[model samples]
Target: MVSFLSCATQTHSLKPRAIITSALPYANGEIHLGHVASTYLPADVTTRFLKMNGVEAYYVCASDDFGTPILIQAEKEKKTPQEYVAHWNKRDYDDFTAFDICFDFFYRTSSPENIQFVRYVFEKLKQNGHIYETEIIQFYCKNDQKFLPDRYVVGVCPYCKAVDQYSDLCEKCGRVPEEIENPKCAICGQPPTKEKTTHYFFRLKNFGDQLTKWLEENEHLQKDVKKYVQNWISSGLIDWDITRDITWGVPIPGDESKVFYGWFDNHLAYISTVMKFLGDKGIDGREFWNSADIYHFIGKDIVYHHYLFLPAMRLGINQEYKLPDYIPTRGHLTLQSKKISKSRNWYIGLRDFLSHYPADYLRYYLVSINPYSQDDLNFDWDDFATRINSELIANVGNLVNRALGFTKKTFGTIPEPDDLDEKDKDAEMKIKTLLSEMTPLMEQNHLDRALKKVMEFSIYFNQYFQHKEPWKKGPGTNSCVYLSVNAVHAIALALSPFLPQSAQKIWVQLGMPGKTTDHPWSAISEIAIQPGHVLGEIAPIFVRVEDADIKARKEELGTK
Candidate 1:
């Protein structure tokens, strides 16, 4: 067995190298804030933090372009699935980039390379006898001439005997609809016939023991998530259907009669996409795909599929395919305190939002108020405006602008503050303590609190500035000026991760050169901004949102 923690570097003390993946965005439609909250933004923060902390991390994601859903959507729109995916893929990529998501590889499921890789795994499982052909009776609507998937069929429930329950499964009884005595197609109200068809099933029950052991050792999974999965495994992991009667997915290796199940095939997409990118770059990508510390970022809804069957498939392959290191699941995002639904047109577009607010502002607000552990976070225009105006603009933005503005105006340069007097000494101590606490908080993924610390430090600096009254007291000698510059530099370093663009703005304005991002986080306290440095013009770090601007966006979102 390949130990996950075997790789170690002399300089890096941490065990294991990591490859992070956000849940692949479906190649169906435009992504909304809910999509960003669930996978993109949170995953980006994790990757950014890890890279900032000196971890060797690669972020991978792709478009889930294959599936009946995509086909169905394409038929409705009178366009080919390729055409559909192409349009949305471009749109989604643009949105993610605009939001500053740093994905190492934005992959697609439709690539021929992905097809080859997926087929290779299928052959491996078949050779191992982990796949079996089975004929099962499933509902078929003759009028539509299409076999109804679990979700597509609907009829009267058998257990509770509720009317119009799903034909494949009854939600009321929570039992398979094949057990239902009598059923009718909800779409046509026609009695459906049970037909036998040949299909393949994954040997999920074979890995029950292995899965149980994996869960037992990895106690980092949240209690609720673990319990839900454990309950499913305890009930039994039946041989999952691995072949679908569809033309939309990867065809079964040598079997012209079947195609690999869309869901099962999609899971292999992450690795395949990586291969495609690496193959394009003329590099062998197998080194990373077969073995790397891969972390999957997903929502709770897909936990079961990812945790059990997905890894089980890999482990069954009897190779060095990497298992997910961590699954950082997040809850849903609500817009205007209500669920964002397409029918209601409540979803806000990223392009529209970016037109008015800066990317950093959105990143700052999302990270600051994220329900990281659990629970839904609400996004209201009023709250967004307030947080930006009061916190970013009034506190973080105001303090940076004022300090630099004062230095530029009074001294014709950025000044560092001198050694603190009694009161000043106490404030400096408090700021240092806050920084000390923030490092670990960020390490633990307590981003909300880390953001709060940023705000707290901002408030502290404001109070310190007001008390010192550098503008009124005249340029505080050379030492005093040096001390002030040092303080501002430390604050800029702290805010870099959350407000990277704005932090870079301050980084340049303070007359500091080089890429702001290359600086080590640990050096935040060193205060590198030198005294006697000629400062650039102090532009508005963050502009206050007016009520009219907020109202216009709110109305636009309402009609979206």
Candidate 2:
């Protein structure tokens, strides 16, 4: 008797569990399309694909409720910081819901749970000798009778000599301020007095060599991201500032008068988000936090915080806590070759975009351009309209409408093919090949290429259907109908990750029993649509966008 055991056929570097976190946008403003395009949308797409592939994945982000921006915005609006954050939190949450961003826990960072974790992590940092005392000269305005936050002061950037830049970072050159030159208070138009304040500093130099080694070792980081991190290491990472003289944030452990810097406390929210999600079910978040396959999808502006400061803090807190497996830091999402600016009213709100178009349409178009892989992509409305109308509607949606609509209206059920041709076999093979090819690209975050490949197949499927002319009653008409319907099924399954809403609608129209997303992702090309399957209700999956609507949007955004 043979006693050989079966070995599994799958190879995996990824574990069973996944956690995705987009960078928390500050609570001072509404969710804009650029934010959604760069971080949230791609993260949502990745989470959808991971879930579809049966990985236990969760997407989380919190409104960055603590920080200079919130306080400054509160003062400008003549409201308390807490009141301001509450209003914007609800607004942003509602906007995300409208845009169909399926976050597991889109909570606020200013919570009791986050405060506890901040304290705990700080204690560990102190114990591990990473925390130290320091004194900093921060800006103070006597008229306001308070220390000015980052956004309340304006100066020419010391690094790039750019005038009228915020004191925290340079807008033109992307430099974090070491010391501002010729600073003045913008709030009261007063020259600020420098006030000395005691602050906590993290001794990052101790971990410099370790961070360098790890950054060099991480293969999953984007090429430019890795280079940027390495350059940071080459420039000599200094002790990081971990305290701010403000009352709106988590206070330092010993002194209630002092608060942790927003950057420090904000990163802790990533952990708090996971903990909150797990805590709802009476589970400790530490177990998963200690070893889960973690990914951070953040904008390029905050690369220093996540790559250097965060991992060092995590290491200081616990050696067992898993280091980041992937950090897909995305560049800016621009409009007409300029960065999106809400201050200038030069960006679209997620709500405004949703009112004009379907959420999935934006999702598809964004992934097609894929702002992450390049420096940036312009959010051209003409491109948006043309891609959706020509590629999505005319090709993919058209294939489903013609194939399934004709089958249901004419035959009432899927017809068994009298004979399969070489073209049918080739189409089936191409579907299977796409399934294999797309998995690697998705795994590597090559979502743009994967999306392009799917559209390529959709174009081929439409051409095949047009060549066959399945509507006319003639010899092999039933066979043509059969092949066309199955090809539609193949396209729907393959597109489930990229355009889930349209995929589900098409799944129903194909007479499938459940949601398209519920089917196994690996079964996309492997499973065949059986003959005689009755069609479900037919409905339009996508609608054509008129040139007038896009023109109106351009005019509203002040674009030429």
Which candidate tops lDDT? 2
TM for every model, in the order presented, reads 0.88, 0.94
Per-residue lDDT for 437 in model 1?
Answer: 68
Residue 536 of model 2, lDDT score: 93
Model 1 global lDDT (CA atoms, 0 to 1) = 0.73
lDDT of 1 by residue, 185-263 (tens): 6456677887988888889889988888788777556666777677777977667887777677788877866677766
* Candidate 1 off by > 4 Å: 1-16, 154-193, 279-284, 289-291, 426-436, 474-484
lDDT of 2: 0.80
Best by TM-score: 2
